[model samples]
Target: MLEIVLMHPDGKLQRLEAPVGVSLMQVATGAGVRSIVAECGGSAMCATCHVYVDPAWAGKLAPPLANELEMLECTSSERRPTSRLSCQIKLRADLDGLTVQLPESQQ
Candidate 1:
């Protein structure tokens, strides 16, 4: 299992242990993390699963694919250097302690 830490805008945090190979959206949504909406499931068609990758764990993840980058451009929130679509992040052993900050809004 891989551990993911999700931080809310108000500073609340949710720690989830998800099986490897699952998308971040799947774990977060299943855990009822209010930060993720996952409106399009894991299709990368919507920005509702947007999250800011913690700089400390940024290098641990793979670069975003073309489709994920395209979808992030449509997010209502400003995209930061750490911005990523949760649907595009898959859990892996190397990402055991992955940490992500929830965006202010997922509209």
Candidate 2:
């Protein structure tokens, strides 16, 4: 399993864990974390699952795909260099302990 940490805008931190091969969105939604919206599920068709990957872990991830880059512009928060769609990130052993910051909203 991989442990991922989510830091909310309000300063609340949620530590979550999931088996390898699942998306962070799946874990967050399943854990009943109130921040993620994930309206299109994991289809990459929506940007509601947007997150800001920690700079320390950002370089560890492969860059986002073209469609994910486009969808990210639709997020309810300002897009940053580390911004990523949670559904586009599949959990992996190497990504254990990854940290992300939730936006103030995910509309």
Candidate 3:
């Protein structure tokens, strides 16, 4: 299992375990992390699963593909340099202990 850390807008933190080959959105939604709406179901069509990758870990992740970059423009929250669509982040051994901050809203 891979571990992920989520920092909520309210300052609460949640640590979740995810199996390899699953997206961050899948782990959050399955764990009832309300901040990750994931309306597009990992298709990267909706930006509801937006999250802010911890700057320290940003370099470890793959750059967002063109499609994901396009969808990011539709996010309900302010997009930052480290912003990412959780559905596009696949879990892997090297990604264990990854940290992300949930946007204030997903709607």
Candidate 4:
């Protein structure tokens, strides 16, 4: 299991314990994390599951694919160097302590 720390826009953090191979969206949505709407589920079709990976853990994740990169343009938050679609982030042992900050809105 990996501990994924989700930082809400209001500054609260929800420490989630999830198994490897599941996408971040499924985990967050299943956990009922308020910030992640997951409008397109884990399909990478919507950017509602956007999050900013903690700089400390950012490089550990794979780069976004073309589809995810295209969807990011529609996110409510400005896509920063750390911006990533949660749907594309698969949990793994290497990401045991991953931390992501939710955007102010996912509309």
Q: Which prediction has more favorable lDDT, 1 or 3?
A: 3
Error of 4 at 50 (Å): 0.4
For model 4, residues 2-94, the per-residue Cα lDDT tens digits are 899998888898898899999988899999887899988789888999999999999999999999999988998788989999999988889
Q: How many backbone clashes does candidate 1 have?
A: 0
Best by lDDT: 3
lDDT of 4: 0.91
Better of 3 and 4 by TM-score: 3
lDDT of 2 by residue, 1-107 (tens): 87999999988888997899999999999999878989998999979999999999999988899999999889999999999999999888999999999998888
Considering summed lDDT, which 10 consecutive residues are worst modelled in model 2? Answer: 10-19
Instruction: For candidate 1, write residues 1-107 as lDDT tens digits.
Output: 87889899999888889999999999999988877899988999999999999999888899999999999899877899999999999889899889999999999
Please give the CA lDDT of all the candidate structures: 0.91, 0.92, 0.93, 0.91
lDDT of 2: 0.92
Instruction: Give the Å error, residue 55, model 1.
Output: 0.6
TM-score winner, 2 or 4: 2
Kindly provide the TM-score of model 4 when superposed on the true structure, using C-alpha atoms.
Answer: 0.96
Clashes of 2: 0
Candidate 3 or 4, higher lDDT? 3
Report the Cα lDDT for candidate 1: 0.91
What does the lDDT read for residue 92 in candidate 1? 90
Give the runs in model 3 whose Cα sits over 4 Å from its true position. Answer: none
Ranking by lDDT: 3, 2, 4, 1
Clashes of each: 0, 0, 0, 0
